[model samples]
Target: MTSQVRGGQLARLLGQWHALPGRRRSPDYAALAAAVRGLLADGRLPLGVRLPAERELAEALRISRTTVTAAYRALRESGHLTSRRGAGSWTMLPGGHRVASSGLWTPQDDLDMIDLGIAALAAPPELVPATRAATEDLPRYLGSAGYHPTGIIELREAIARSYAERGLPTSPEQIMVTNGTQHALDLVLRLALAPAGSVLVESPTYPNALAALAARRARIATHGLALDAGWDADLLLASIRQSRPRLAYLIPDFQNPTGHLMPVDLRERVVGAAHAAGTDLVVDESFVDLPLDGTPVPPPTATFDRHSRVITIGGMSKPYWGGLRIGWVRASAPQVQRLAAARIGVDMSSPVLDQLVAVHLLADAATIVAARRTQLAHQRDALLAALAERLPQWRVTVPRGGVTLWAELDGPVSSALARAAEEVGVRLAPGPRFGLDGTLERFLRLPFTLPAADLVDAVHRIAAVRYDLDRAGRPQWREPSVIA
Candidate 1:
């Protein structure tokens, strides 16, 4: 269905639109056109939704109406917009630039379906034994009221000790157990960000993190990441200085989707910059334990923190299993108290049984994670090999660790490929899902969480889908079902 975006709303969504990233001054009409095009490409601006009239937008942005008209005209020429004499102009993607309507993908239940949309692994072999141990240890708390808002002492100590082992000295008073990384992030957002506050994030980051920011209606500032040049400390510092965001969310360890690990020196530089800018950094360490290669992984981002400005989020979902539902936040004791107090209005506490299970799992994490790395290495190799043999035209960066490969297709047909893969019962997430403003259409994320055989099969199915798309000159573009 077609809908209209009011001038005020569009103006807010395009915060600092005149100051394009990496530019020295305000943009002209052509630059304005490119920014709107970026919004349309990254799925932030919906296709087929009517935009505010040129005069209305000009007044809202406090610019001249002629500039808006020229920008609209440029958009029309680029095929990103359509206009009628009486109907007005609406957004649209140019030919061969189709993308998924939604960035979120739900799991499918078909027996034969090969689901790669979610980058998660099955439970490790040690889970059952750990759960049994937890059950045995549950009786000690049977007589209690079963309410520990700050989490039980046992799990908190285990998490804190784990941090200490990684060169960051932490105490149980500084840890607050939570449901998962997403839940922890939500709690941090609630505590750190005011409504409409600015936030800085890496472009092509975790999709759910984007959802969290969107939920709060936060103004997002982005720093782009690429396989060729990983994290640019100077560029990141510039973004921090320019945007002056209230909070910054990053996935430095085997960063989601891209799987590029931040160097130790880079981490220190980034932490120092954020501290200087007074921007609280929320570092996600969910994928820290799944290093498939032998390279030395850097210590947690909080290790470089001298002023307690960094909050580290860690969880068992990625390494052990997603079903555990056990995650924790490491911050200063006072910060932990603040978060725990705020969490009362949310979930009072995590499940006792799950927390108990986590206690046992953390005890043997080293052994279990070693086995997991071996398994993941095999699967990662299998996936790379299959793609090398079948889809050699596509470019893929080899990640030292992490479970996913960021694949770049020869053309901007990621959304079309995902749609076609559904026909063969192979679910895939397009590259735009990991990006902001409907960008990264030429990329796709392929996880190696499945078994070696299943990874091979998925690659075979994807190869077939690409072959069909190539044969047909790409699928016909379909209008998105919903626009918001």
Candidate 2:
């Protein structure tokens, strides 16, 4: 790239973080370095791109040359950048290897059959009007470039306000809107945590989270979160205290598959332990709005996190619609800037139309949440009843919120069991799909994403298949509920 292009890109990048706002005071070295590293993460600065001279950057910003010097030195030490006297600075993506993405999102061979595979709910009704308004307002910003690396202020502010309502006081600068919870989590993993860093995770966490972490080659440490009853605080606290990892990932509120909420005290304890060990915590709160039974639990991990070290990821996919593809992270302003920079390589920015659609959910979240809770509660009850009547041999847990159920079977072969069920036309998530060691072999996950009639049919099919297996001398089993 030409010097002019590089210079302009660098300035725009810095401006995204408000670090280099053109001809003003010099940027903070630490913040500038963070932004620069993010640029490298997204391939904005390719491998071995010659960085601008420290003196030139300083002169452009009209600040002390030492600031740019320190920023370059910081990048070099972090291994994100390197320098030679004649060659100047060179940008490099953090670490060397690019871990291949895990290919795991496949559905069955049906020409549009019942998809019990994806744990997604139908789109909420409230999305209609919220979407209409965002589309109406899009023309107002259409006149400008509309790059929106920082996301629309209205959505950022809305997300932060939502966090504040949950007892985690936040500001717009601390948030970076992404395509979905997966996008936010992926960006945070790329920017804050280095590749191959030890990633502490609950046994059977959301599967996609596992894929995202694996893509970075993060060493996975699985702590078993009991699906039979709920989260094992002892396991979580001990893991955080002893692991001392670079990152501790959790789905505390209505954990995936298992649908267990870590009690408020336990949430605080885990946060405290992570903080004490100086490990960054990534809390996936995608189910924040979907407490199906009883009053929702008050367990916002970020509220206990003072430094925004606990990056809370939430999205519209869980509560609203998967197609909307909106999720965000609640972090400090500096961290938000870092995420925005890191995201560019993977995607220039999340689609504006989707962002606007999400604004619909944010605008009237309460009504949408209430309707979801009621609908999910009904579905949960229906599934439970169906399982009890048909799959009596299998043990199941009733979750308070969210989409899926984790259950243990009479024998130790959920994978084999799932294969058997598939023979009869029902595709179930095998227990081994959740656990890395295949320990949860006696378990199965049932998602309530389908309608009540379909779920009932699925349970009936599962029970009939189980009976056949039992009669044939095969002991059926399942794994723990989560999949990380």
Candidate 3:
């Protein structure tokens, strides 16, 4: 059965479609078709999902019925949309196969591909030593079953002590280990949110978090962030009061995509709002340890948790290494128990050897993170300089921390550009992947985890692709103004 999207919902998804960037005149039907094609190509619009009627969409967008008709006709001609006499129009890929709904431009094991889709770094030099130490410690537990559901004691205590160092007193019993922060988030959503529950999230949040929510079939309400100003506590407070979602997944520490850190004062207010609304604040601190600018990091959000509902999730992926696959949740002891019980149905527990390795790594986290920060800073500077030299019209805020940059493009052609870049062996994560519906077409996420030289080369290739796209008069071209 095809899932149907209503006209109003489609309108919300196609935000400001007619008011396209750099286009002085009203958008023609070609622009509309291109935007829809972009959405399909990027996987924001899933295949087999029924689209709204042309007249209905035209009414919702306040455009002529003829414009919508022409756009649909173009889509059908291109094999992007299919319609039947009795059945309405539905989305489809050109070859009628499923594409990854993650909306990432992925390279299929292409060695030449420069991947900027994921924001993870290579393992630090300390990992080998840590693994060696962990192997020595592993035999001590060989006598018993290696299943440690709530994580091995050593790792749990180390994680708790790390939180204590950050001014939040956490006990080992309050921590529950999982595969990673993503797994931890899934566990929390399963335990905290009921079926069809509502979740409040930032407009451009971590894409995987949105995926998790969608998998759980949760209703999402978003709070938009101003790229220049960052988060507005007042606006968030209003949203909490109005929507009263069951959970608010926040990434305040160098917030994902945007890279905006929440000030201490705003942190307090955000916690208060969630508390007032009785919302479980799932605060993701995965990127907390990567402050490249030496900005004074604020205390953990758990510091302001008046209620026991603030579930603080931390991981070694961003700071240490993604392959570690170790993460933990810091909540009240009872909450930890509940999460652990629920986790048994999934993967019984994380790998015992990995947990042992995590213990060794956490003991030396500060030194490792400091060196990692220096390397990231260098790469980030390289990427920024390259973007400035090649694509200065695309606006990018200088992020103090985090692995990725949220860049506003020169026009609303991010998806089109991403597809074009693939021809030159550069993979991209278009802006719409991080947003709800088909929104954020005017933005893109660029990660700086690659080597400095590689990052610069990737940017150069992307710039060349954009130039070609512009010159070819592709569907992404903005129509110029006309004087009668």
Judging by TM-score against the true structure, name the best candidate: 3
Tell me each candidate's TM-score.
Answer: 0.80, 0.74, 0.85
Task: Quote the positional error of residue 81 for candidate 1 in Å.
Answer: 20
Question: Which candidate should be chosen as best, given lDDT against the real structure?
Answer: 3
> In candidate 1, how many Å is residue 175 off?
0.5
Per-residue lDDT of 291-409 in model 3, one digit per residue for the tens?
98787899998899878969999899999989989998999999999999999888889999999999989889878989999999999999999999999999999999999898999
Where is model 2 more than 4 Å wrong at Cα? 1-112, 470-484
Q: Which lDDT tens digits does candidate 2 get at residues 1-484? A: 4232255446654554442222134447766775565344322344566777777777766667898888888778766676677867776533433311111112223332344557888887677787788789889778877778768888888888887787777899988888889988899999977878998988887777877887797889988877576677787778878888999888888888788888888878888888899899999998868887575678588888876668888888988899887888888888888888888888877777778777767778888878877888888888999988877777887887888888888887565456556556666666656656335768778888778988888888878877776444321112112323
Predicted candidate 1 versus true structure: per-residue lDDT over 349-447, tens digit per residue: 998999999999999998999998998899999999999999999999898888889998989778657766766777788888887755787999999
lDDT measured at residue 33 in model 1 versus the true structure, 0 to 100: 80
How big is the positional error of residue 251 in model 2, measured in Å on the Cα after superposition?
0.5
Clashing pairs in 3: none
lDDT (0-100) at residue 266 of candidate 3? 87
